[model samples]
Target: MKYTVLSLFPEIIDAYFASSIMAKAVSRGIVEYRPVNIRDFALDKHKTCDDAPYGGGAGMLMLPEPLGRALESAGARQRFVESAGAGSAGRSSGRVIYLSPGGRPFTQDVAVELSREAELILLCGRYEGIDQRIIDTYVDDEISVGDYVLSSGEVAALALIDATYRLVDRVITAESLEEESFSGGLLEYPQYTRPEIYDTLRVPELLLSGHHENIRRWRLRKRVEKTLALRPDLIRRGEEIGLFDGETRKLIQELGGEG
Candidate 1:
């Protein structure tokens, strides 16, 4: 899929696009990135994109004009479809997401939802934030990566891209996505490789045992145990959503947990 990052700091986002899976994806044309500098669309000689906030604020607010015009001229929808090898999705009405502190909390489900879209434009807010006019005019959704604030949205945008891109068809193995954390409504069980023994701790015996059935049972138990101990909320929510089977229900009861 095509990812258009509207940022004042395009360099920060560009640096990451050149390496690892993203780099390879770009080369293969499986995914593409276009980082538009908000300032590039500025009309004045200074090419300014921010100004002191009206009504009094500590930091400057990004202007609406440059960002809006940049998104319009850059053909946000066209680039995103071509990047994903999906061809041009006419008029790219997919999603225009704004990254901000007050946005809806992001989740694995959200990532999965976004991966299905043909195109996405992420607005990276800076300083205090972007002008409200920009958000009202173009934003499809507002999403926050986490509770705490970061210095810039560039990092958040990269993270969102990595999570969403890997879910695209052929970007990574389907089985790999299936095994990742949160894939099954529970965290993944521990994985081990190479040296059988690390320091004094050995790999779990069940993982090494040749009995596939027994190993599967062991992994399921561990996944339930770990989720119960660390993220009981997930289990509760999972059960509410009809994700738990009789076997899993019995397991939870055996562990002195409800639902």
Candidate 2:
């Protein structure tokens, strides 16, 4: 899959892409990414991308011309102009998403949905926000990482990328992805490593047992227990989705969770 990010601050994107699993994935060609600077598409000598709102507002609003051109360069549309010898897809496009506080709540499901796309163009808005015309013209969806606001959308874009990329084939082991929090509507069971004893507390005995069956059951029970303890809402939703089987349901009941 290819990910194209349109941001005024490409440096932020660069730092993240330069390290860890993202770096390895890019090197192996398992995933491709390109960061396009919104400023690069600015039209004038001042290289300005934002201006005061027409009706007036608290902060400057990003200009439609620069942002529209940036999205065009990022593949929001198929049309092209010859100045830079580029097309609407300066990179490519499967979906165009704008990161904003007023967008759909982003979740693991959304990450899974995006990971299936052949390409994704992420727009990171700044200042007051992008011109509405840009969103109406090119955006397929708008997504938010959380209820709170952040200084820049690049941070949110990186978060969306992190959640989606790890699910891509060859990015990580399939088992590693499946056994994680939110994988099956439940938080993952706690994990422990060497140094069995820490702060006078020992790792769970079941995890140490060589018996695989008992350990598996223990993990499942603990998964339900933890979800119920920390997020009963998830337990309720999981039950509605039939995410738990008969044994798991029984386990939830044992933990005082409604089936």
Q: Which candidate achieves the best lDDT against the true structure?
A: 2
lDDT of 2: 0.88
- Candidate 1 lDDT, tens digit per residue, 1-259? 8888988889998988898888988899988888888888998999999889889959899887888798786664333333555654455454788898889988999999999987788889888889987776667789999998987988888878888998999887888877567867887877899699999999888788889999877777878888899989988898889887888788888887786
TM-score quality measure for candidate 2: 0.93
Which consecutive 10 residues in model 1 have the weakest lDDT in total? 76-85
- For model 1 the TM-score comes to 0.91
How well is each residue in 107-166 modelled by candidate 2, as lDDT tens digits?
999999999999989999997888887777678899999999988999999999999999
Cα lDDT computed for each candidate against the true fold: 0.83, 0.88
Q: Output the lDDT of residue 69, model 1.
A: 91
Cα error, residue 157 of model 1, in Å, equals 0.7
Question: Considering only N, C-alpha and C atoms within 3 Å, which residue pairs clash in candidate 1?
Answer: 1-84, 2-80
List runs of model 1 lying over 4 Å from the truth: 76-91
Clashes (candidate 2)? 3
